[model samples]
Target: MSEYHLDIFMHIPKTGGMTLNEIFKKQYKLSEIYDHDSFQKKMMNMDELTEVEKRNIKAITGHYFYGIHQEFSRPFNYFTMLRDPVDRVISSYYFLRDYPGYEMVKDMTLEEFVVKGPEAPNLQTLMVCGSQEIPDIEIAKENLKTFSVVGVTELFNETLFCLKKEYAWGDIHYTRKNITKNRLAKDEVPSDLINLIKKYNALDIELYDLAKQLLNDKLQSLTEDEQNQLKKFNLEQSL
Candidate 1:
């Protein structure tokens, strides 16, 4: 039997995924690490960590696209977190531009940045993980097919509720997000890019709706504004 019920946490950047990773590491005896920066290592990360550390590992997350491959020799569960595509794209813009590497783009205005998008300097990582490549929606669904659960960013507590039913994880700690003062980046994503993201990530949208329907009762408990927030998308195109 496996020590952990593995969940992938298909990370949609700036969508509280790291917060999830932090909770997994600090709260659960099992530590889930997100290998965002150095994905080249794969299992070498596990090999290098202390056995005690490895034993505490419950999951590995981040925008690990392509395939699901882990060194752990046991059956495991899979899960990922997703946000509405529009917000997701906007966050990607800021995360890349504000954070490291994207310093090259700091000088460009949002209008300039949107046109330059994906190709914006040092934004390859954000492009690959964000809507630029694999749609955030598709990444979440494809991840869901591989894992037992799909955690909605809009309804994360319930996602954890389901997971904890099996793991008996105690009091999941997390800060609820709302009305933060941070300005949005890539604020007005052009229609062309919006349609492009839809084409690439059709499945992600489907999965998110499916997840919402699956957790309707739990989601209904949210505020009206919070409930509508799920529909926010980077594009006006009909999905």
Candidate 2:
């Protein structure tokens, strides 16, 4: 791993990142953390910043590609969450349909959105792969391996547990946010659409599976007490 002056949260869209953002905010000082909006705005002016100014930023969270790391002068740790591709695409479709800026998908049917949206396919893989064009799968896998934390949205609690152990972060508590509205239940979505999602996001499905296995492996390594602690945290969040 590279020596890092800060941690970068490469937030994948509609992957429970909104909730994680809240959790991360509590773990770092206000002066040390930049939320997504602020981070992007700051990046535009980064070239003018001195080394000390850049080093002062302890953490940055945003929806951005891997190459953002190149903009920084010092090394930084990366973290991100991956989601089940089918579910993620479904969520993204609905989320963008209503979002003010995404007029392109505003009136699109789910099918149309999946087929036509510029960022609808293999987005998770694209983000990590660090390219606008077709991404290299091996590079994406290697990039994820270098992350200080690579989490899965489906296994969010376990991911939190992994982060707690890996970084000794404070209070892993989180409440869900940015849930897609009127989402069809997995069983409710038609098989044809599901297949289409799979076809469009094949790489994301592979990446998601990799993340799941990695998370499961990390969970397996936890001591009984650590597992119990995570359980306790889950139980607390439920109430």
Candidate 3:
């Protein structure tokens, strides 16, 4: 089987994860799992599952961050997106702070935010990606060791282009997410706060940098079914 057949689209929240997951499902017809807990909680809470259940899973999506400490490794791939920490935290803070599930951050500032708070987005980010905790570069790479095609969210279109050219897919375009319809700059984020965000989201940054280096102009390394699926969907959209 082609590497892309085992493609795993890791869900990194507040970074266009939702929109991208849709694309993978629309294109590949792979089993898409989101809301994350379905897999992470199942895998984390349970010690084992029957081989039938394992074969039933084609594409596990919706945020399994780290490498699960189990012998469930199969012919599968891994993938996710990364964004600038400063922007990610800021974006997440606004998107969910006032939402029902994120009541904790209803009135907190980035400087005031902590991981355990109700509005803690990173915690969810880790869970969705299958990691037990937040990631650093070395740790994330280790966690997603099974992934074959890792894409950078900030430059997602570029990554999609490569996936299209290399794989049988023509182009994997997706609608952007977490866009602010209005603009209001309340206060400037302190440089120190920005630095803190960068410090914490180091793993994402490293992944972005590494993906840029490794997958440059690389072709003939994609699954035909995945590629054809993407191409057909894109054409249908055009018509």
lDDT per residue for candidate 3 within 1-239, as digits (tens), equals 36424456667666677777666666543232322445423433223444654555555565554553233566665666665555666777777665677787777776666343432434433543455654344654455444455556566665665654444463456666557433223246777776666665555556555655545433245467745755665576456
The TM-scores of all predictions, comma-separated, are 0.60, 0.91, 0.66
Worst 10 residues of 3 by lDDT: 28-37
Q: Judged by TM-score, which candidate is best?
A: 2
In terms of TM-score, which candidate is stronger, 2 or 3?
A: 2
Q: Write the per-residue lDDT of candidate 1 for residues 28-48, one digit (tens) a residue.
A: 332445355332345454456
Model 2 lDDT per residue over 166-195, tens place: 877877777688788887767789999999
Candidate 1 has its poorest 10 consecutive residues by lDDT at 230-239
Q: Residue 106's C-alpha lDDT in candidate 3?
A: 71
C-alpha RMSD between model 2 and the true structure: 2.3
The reply for model 2, stretches above 4 Å from the true place, is 1-4, 37-45, 48-50
On lDDT, the stronger of 2 and 3 is 2
Model 3, stretches more than 4 Å misplaced? 1-5, 30-54, 68-73, 114-131, 134-136, 142-146, 165-167, 178-188, 202-204, 215-239
Give the per-residue Cα lDDT of candidate 1 at 97: 69
